[model samples]
Target: MPTGPALRIDLFLLAGLFPGLTHAAALGAAVDYAVAAERAGFDGVWLAEHHFSAYGTCPSAVVLAGHLLGRTDRLRVGTAAAILPNRHPIALAEETALLDAVSGGRFDLGVARGGPWVDLEVFGTGLDRYGHDGFAAALDLLLAGLSGAGTVAGDRHRFPFREVAMVPVAERGLPVWVAATGSSTVGLAAARGLPLLLGMHDDDAAKAAMLHGYARAGTGTPRAGHASTHLALVADTVEEAEAALRRTMPAWLAAAGGSERIDGSAPPRRDAGAYLEHLLAIHPVGPPARCVRRLAATVSTTGVRRLLLMVEGAGERRRTLANIERLGREVLAPLRRLH
Candidate 1:
């Protein structure tokens, strides 16, 4: 369990891609937000990966990290998750290593087994074969390769050498994070002593159950981290913030494949009211003082060592960025002082 002081906060680039925003615009916003987060005393900024979908534009998070690295001075840039199956271990290792080197070792790697059947089908990658066992194997190889202990080789690709090391290894090992959505994956990550990055779509009970299972399987007091993301807009009035959330919630939930439905309802179905309830359940959305109180409560209840704020929803980019700035200045700052 996390002890003493509140968990470190990070600003997540949740709205990496949207219908109105172009890929270049999204990337630019991400880079700009990285600088903003650093200036606002954030611990890091995380970019997500998605493919062939307007939900997110970042098909290659490593490349995005490289761009962000050149733009920011002290901020640690990382992928909220890079889908492992879409990438070869050696290539992934090399790309991450290069980014780490360029950023002067300010890189964290978060990988997931993959998400959404549509994405997997588009990539021609089958989740049938790349389930738990394959994920563990790939993770083992990825970690070993990243840590400079293993050689990568196969019929299609090879890093051929007796004891070749992955280049640009961090002075300390890069923190490898596993994005776990299910209990089994959470347990696997914990049992393997890896940090877990819980996604935003999970409900309170589901999240708590996953974390509890993780604790049960975790060994030797390993550190745990998680991020609860939703449409956050901290205005002077809760009504204004809620109104913004209402506008963005439907589209945002739709893009997430309508997974926010938790009332025994089938997914991919949009109900504005249900979605708003779902968003309120997961995110800290309100006025600044209220937002701070809510966030602190979430941290205490969840036992997550990190909190990631996603001020950007499927709303206007400029408005979202302005909200992010206000959140950092008003909400997070006071929370930090309280802690």
Candidate 2:
């Protein structure tokens, strides 16, 4: 068993349109995953947002969360992130407030400074808002709106508005997490006393550094717990786990090729095989014992309590369900004993 604190395991749903599945089918599988996760005794489920791509089908994470919230009673549903650059701050705040009220505060709002994707043009937020300054401005407006301030204004992008009180204001500052991939964004989130949502690609050391940076920049104490994502799977053997991932992830990664920057400068395409190897090497993808070891290392090294595991690497819905069952029974059960 792990020598560290027990984990609060949650499932990370990409709502991915894997090979041989329609958009509707992919969404159906996501719903099943959420319901199954709650039944499996997961703490929560986070939904990822992607637009105009087969890599992920869910365009609006907030909307998906609303549907999932109605489907389950005890499960906490959140946007892995709702893209901050793609929508107005007030509109997003209002939606978050409504969901928080209806769900009895089971709803979490995690926002990302989305890339320079075509989503910016489609949403008419422009490419400028994809930068650091713009994201800071947008985040500021969002905080004000959620904090029950009578009026809100923007600094750099200058989205100024008159004195307008937010209706159905959050009883307290609603739970908010900012997705941070770099030190700059981590510092931005920290200065405001907001917890971060770290991605899966980074290793334990890198994640630890980000957390340390946030601690240094922010107030002595954090407002809420920070969250991190990881690639996870549970099977009978290491080879079996690797085989399942090798069979499915290549196609999904291939579909996710090419950055969607509107500036007409496309980054080089990714090599699926190489990337998959890197992910397997970094994450936990073996049997229950091995999975526990890797996860415990993360908790010990980074001091993070919440982990969102991506278990859909097996592609098929039945296999994904089986993975969840095994993880809950074989992995989570043992880890729970550690606490």
lDDT of 1: 0.70
Which predicted model would earn the best TM-score? 2
Q: Candidate 1, residue 35: CA error in Å?
A: 2.5
Off by over 4 Å in 2: 1-6, 150-157
> TM-scores across all candidates?
0.85, 0.95
lDDT of 2 by residue, 1-339 (tens): 444444678999998888889999999999999999999999899999999989889999999999999999999998889999999998999899899999988898899997888889988999778888888888888998888655555543358566666877876877679999998999899989998999987999999999999999998656668888999999889999999999999889887875477877785688998899988998889989999888878887898888899999989999999989888889887766653
Backbone N/Cα/C clashes per model = 0, 0
Candidate 1 structure, TM-score to reference = 0.85
Model 1: runs farther than 4 Å from truth?
1-6, 16-19, 116-125, 150-164, 203-205, 223-230, 258-273
Each model's C-alpha lDDT? 0.70, 0.87
Task: Name the TM-score of candidate 2.
Answer: 0.95
Model 1 Cα shift for residue 215 (angstroms): 1.3
